[model samples]
Target: MGAGLAMQTAVNAKLRDFVLSPYLSSGFSFLMAWVFLLLLNLVTRQPLLISGTFITHNPSWLWLGGFFGAIALTGNVVLFQKIGSLQTTVLPIMGQIIMSILIDQFGLFQSPANPLTWAKGIGLVLIVSGVILSLGLFEPRDPLLKAAERHAGKGSQLFYQLFAILAGMLMAMQTAINGYLGTTLHSPIRASFISFTIGVLSLILVNLITHAHFSNIRLALKQGPRYWWIWIGGIIGALYVLCSSWLVPLIGTGQVVVLALFGQLVFSALVENFGLFASQVNRMTRAKIIGLVVMFVGVLTVKFITF
Candidate 1:
């Protein structure tokens, strides 16, 4: 599932190249996922509508999971194009870890409460240190870092970094909210479908407000046969969403998030090192390897180390 999330970022980044607008690319991705989920729900005989009494009883904020998802997905598409896969992956991960900690500690969004502990605190510090190492911050001469500094001014670069972290935070929130929604809806698939439906609507509103060009959609379709892989992004996204919703209920959100983060970190490293999906090649250095090891340890500490 985490690998799918990383691939979704790469695929959507490529899709943005053809679509010429992040909003459109993300909207199309959500649309495809929505359609796929809709079909799956139909085939599986899942109910599309829930009772108004159920709706009235639950908090309205529960429905905003898809809204948060739309922003996070769109933000990832934009960040991947701007910061390369490595930064795009790690920055959001930092935010995700922090947000997941908050959710677990406070029982936010109706998730089970697991208060913060010294081990968890130490784990977070290690994870942050690992992220810094993975980013090659100590090596001032790294090619990717220099390139980013040269291309985007310090102000713009900082903005993108912050945005990436914000996107990750929203993703964590979306997971928790969708988990509760799944419990309420009694079907993870239905929860996924609802999430995608709201995501589509959110993207549509954003596209309309931004006056995004619709012509690019036509161009993408014309070029679709040659770049067939781009279309699979939505399918992958659908699966990731379904898995998260399903897993979060069975396991805790923090566990599911950290496990997914592990998958994302490993797969994204592969994507960066190998230049998969036509992305830029950013070789994994020794520092990055050590950083990954530290992160793995941190994840273990957070998951297994008790009071």
Candidate 2:
């Protein structure tokens, strides 16, 4: 899922000019995935269902995972609700950075070996530091934070911490895998469709075993261009997968990851301050500005410093 987020920027960079209406390509890719998933449902005997009531009452943007710290943590979300927010946030990010360094060092998942350079290593450390500092993850906890952990009932959650860290490592692995698949297929659109289709099947199988139920299925999807931005999430998703696939072939994997993170931080600030695309106004902070600058430098150092 993190790779899914990182890949779109690469897609935008790579395929923006080469393709005829890249978003349209993205749309078709999603459509293909849906068709594949629909077919899978036929053989698998699990209808793609949803909770109609749960979605009907929520703001539409919630579907895009904009709530961030809540669902982004997933399994750790429950743990986060138990432990303080800082530990949960910090562990995964630290874990991801550590794993990405290893992935680059070993050239995992068909990646060309981009052995860790001194500059790259230092930059990654700075990036991690900035992430922790900007989020105040290292700051002292307040009473509310301590109170919130009551559900966890005051015990060492070493297990969830390790689990969260492993999840971050898995994200790094996912990006490499996606990049490899995209390169092999020679089409980001096809690669993304395949990824999405597989994801749908995987989730459906999970739901089938769990015997999950939903209040309703959201069937009122519209493809009109005017309403395009609303469903643009799908386009962005397919586009990112395509971009990552294309980028891995050129820049190796870690640089793609760094550049994508830099891009996300830059644009996310813009969206938050201006309330673009129905996003919330997060008002950038001094620390956040510092963090972005540090991250940008890290990205430049990682990508441009040819050692």
Candidate 3:
């Protein structure tokens, strides 16, 4: 999943340009994802609706989750163009863990203020180290994967890396915000729907003001593409938004970050194993396995360890 993970942000943004205005694309990504999930629940006979009155008449600030998401997604496009995807993924994740620590400690963005502790510190270090190791920071990477880095402008790398870091850190905050919003609504899915709706409206206004690019999107609507996989980003993103919103309040954002990282690391390996989404099949390395083990310990340490 190395390539796929790296490209998803940029590809999602680019896909937006092709399918709709940039901001609409951003907002609409969630819309597509919500629709797909609704269909999935229908097909699986799973219950979809839940209580959601607070979403309609809650804090005005609660509506900003999608706005943050749109900016974060667009920042990734620039990062991919400047620093390549590996750096984009690794640096941002590290930034995310750090920000998770800060957010949890301060209860930033309505998150419950969980005091920072030694065990959490140790776990954070372990998780960060494991991520670095899993990415093969000290080891050689594939020549093909390295090709993207080669084309990157050296002068801009640091700036882009910083952008990636900031974006990653913001991701944690966004999740926390969404979690708070979801709690108000009494349903994560409902909160997700509102966030997407607000985001879609905001982007639409922006697009209309900037370039009035409705024609392009209208054309896309008229002549749909043949490929099925282009819409996959929405599905994956919906899962992230929904799960993070549901899990953050239950587990606290700190544990949610660690657990999410673990899941990402594990699923990345699985995706690579099967070459899902045409990502390069990576042979599992002993080092990566060791890193994963360390990350699991980190998760346990973060969630269960106290003194």
Candidate 4:
């Protein structure tokens, strides 16, 4: 859990750097992650550390899952730049709560549990209300008045918010894919390694086609991007995806996302207000404070109110 928090912090910081494109950060992060995992394997002398069974047994799900993961990463990194970390993170909670209900109740994704009950229903409502409060969606005025107002305007902010929400939905897809993959594939690490590598490669291709910033690439490699801290964001993303894929099967995707949301609330508060590790400290507002509390309550209810 601590490791996941650290990785997420790295991701948020990378987004703030406003550096060599979101795609670049994501791709580079995966490349770096591949290297990081390899290094660990080399140092520990554990060839089995990240097994090959993931590819041998069921290659299709890894590829399919990688596709959604790429989308999720692109949306999340961009949304982080636009909507701020806390707001962006909350969007996933909303999607996961909804998706979990449908998937679990109907066995859409072949979830271990089936047929959602009243407890889950009530928990979902609480989560929805908490998201509204946390996001300040219910407030009449711009909920983020104290925070940096979107330079783009209402339409732009709305677009960014939607991007954040879409990122969440894509992540939910990735969770289901990973859970399915986990069952057939023996090693979680190997499956994660492959999925991230494919996703990262895909992002690179897309980025080169869209932007084709050869000059920026040269500069980033040499001196690093303007905000190099953003690289940590990639590292965080790599670790988070790997671990999340591993954990979600054991616990449901809904539970894992809920836990992650709780972590985001605390980490985002520190990142935005206190500026931990020299990160930007966005202004806090009264509505946001109240919203944070509401989110906490929602998390507690979701965790304990199991049917």
Candidate 5:
């Protein structure tokens, strides 16, 4: 699922090229995923309408997963423009790890309570260190870091950074909430469809408010056939969402987040090394390899070690 997410990122980047607006591309992607899950639920004989009993009995927060997702998507775009991609990536990850830990420790969103242990603490540190190393952040002169530094005033930068962390926390909360929603609905597929539906509606509102060029949608359709691969971003994203909803209940949210992060980093390294999808070639360095090893160790520590 994490690898699929990385692919979705690449595919969405290409889709953004055709649509000429990230908001439009994201909304379109959500629309496609919504349609896909709608069909899946229909074929699987799942009820299209959510029962009133389920609605009346469940907490209202269960329904906010998609709204949170939409906000996170929008936040990423804004952060990408305001802060460099490096900070955009790292800050959210930090937020995700921290939030996931809190959720697991406190049994937030009705998730199972798994109090933090010493081994888990060590694993968290290693995982964070690995992320920093893999991104080459130890070098004070990294171009992306310098670019981010030049982009904002100190106060504004701190605000954007905090917003980025909040976005990440929202992402983790969304996963946990959706997992519970799936259990309540008795179908992860339906939960995914509903999530996408809400996300699409939210994005539609955002696009309208921002005056996003709807003309780009028509342009993208005309040019879409030439780059058929871009259309699959939504499908990939749908699967990722479905898997996250399904997995969270089975293996706590923290594990799901860590495992997915590991997959994302590993697959992203391969993508950069191979120069796939017209991405720039950045051959894997020793630091990246060492970081991967550390990340792997961290994953094991978190997953298998208890004492």
Candidate 6:
């Protein structure tokens, strides 16, 4: 899981390097994803297309999801660019676990998960505590304070942090909506394809209204043919998503999230600690190591309480 999440982060970082408009990144990715799936369909002699009714009959809440997704994807690219892969990867898992718990507990947006329990409830408290420790929120003297202020330029670091949180919340919403759609449509891949396709289309329409340059669109696609590996990320991303959908219905959404969180935390730590590929990850401090440990403990608490 950690490796996959790291790859996802790396994919976002690669997207950021191109410096295209946000909508273009998402739009091109969706197009690439569709093409990849089409190629798979041809190889297997199976039709993998979504129907028109799926789009037209979507609930208003799902439409709300498209709104969140547009912001989230754009924010993810920007955040990954701004903060590098490690913190961007770690912070969002914290946000997602908490948001998912609230949605599951309260039935917010009509999610289909069971209510929170004693173990899960304590798990929430542990998660909050863990995030605080992981972020070094209580440190008397933060090591990165001076450097962070110097490097962040113009906008506040708080803004970047908020963007990360918003991205995570939108991700949580996207996950819950996928679960609902899977239950309603009885097809995981179809649900994911439709949801992602609609979100990308909605973003593209917004860009059209804003008069974003057509050249950026072309430029984004041009890079795809030039760098096949980057475009391949979309294929792996789509497949991971499809498998996630299938797993959620069989194993439960919360369980799937817990596993994803564990995967992300571990991989993000390794990538950051070793500075693999000359990534922005700096020397690991004792506090950061402690933070990762706390976060993992919180995950264990979350899983144990539920079981």
* Of candidates 5 and 3, the better by lDDT: 5
Q: Tell me the lDDT of model 3 at 277.
A: 43
What are the per-residue Cα lDDT tens digits for candidate 2 across 1-307? 3433433323322222222233333333344445654564456554344367845854453232111211222334243333323334345555667777787799766567778998878777776666656554455667885686565554556667666667566655665565555455454454445556554444454445655432111221322344333333445554555566667779876577666665555654565456444433446567667766775676566556766
Using lDDT, give the best candidate's number: 1
lDDT, candidate 6, 1-307, per-residue tens: 4467566556655654563665566556656665665565466555456467976776768656545666776676677667756668766776777787788778876775667777776766776666666665566665586676677663766788777877888888887777677666666555666666676677678778867665754554577555544555456567767668667769875577667777777776676677653356655666766777777777667665665
lDDT of 4 by residue, 1-307 (tens): 5335534544544642444677766666667777765665456554433346745755454567677877776676667667766776677666755765666677655566666667766777766776677776666665466354654577888888777766667676676766666555555665566566677778779877878463555554454554555556556666776677668779976577667777777677666666555545666677777777776676566556666
lDDT of 4 at 213: 61
Model 3: how far is 77 from its true place, Å? 5.0
Worst 10 residues of 5 by lDDT: 80-89
TM-scores for all candidates?
Answer: 0.93, 0.57, 0.69, 0.78, 0.83, 0.80
How does each model score on lDDT? 0.88, 0.50, 0.64, 0.64, 0.76, 0.66
Cα lDDT for residue 301, candidate 5: 78
Stretches of candidate 4 off by over 4 Å are: 2-18, 39-62, 138-151, 221-228, 241-258, 276-280
All predictions: root-mean-square deviation over Cα? 2.0, 13.0, 5.8, 4.4, 3.4, 3.8
Pick by TM-score: 3 or 4, better one:
4
Candidate achieving the largest TM-score:
1
How many pairs of residues in model 2 come into backbone collision? Answer: 7
* Candidate 5 residue lDDT tens string, 1-307: 7777666666666677778788887888888888999999889998888778888998899889999987786666556546534445555766776787899899999999989999889988987787667656565566785776677566887798899889888988998898888887778888888888889999999899989998887776787456788788788888888787678879976577668876766676676678666555667777767877786677667656898
Q: Indicate the worst ten consecutive residues by lDDT in candidate 3.
A: 1-10
Candidate 3 local lDDT, 234-307, one digit each (tens)? 66677766666567668775576556665555655665555444444557677777776776687678667888
- List clash counts for every candidate, in order: 0, 7, 0, 4, 0, 1
Q: Lowest lDDT 10-mer window, candidate 6?
A: 224-233
Model 5 lDDT at residue 38? 91
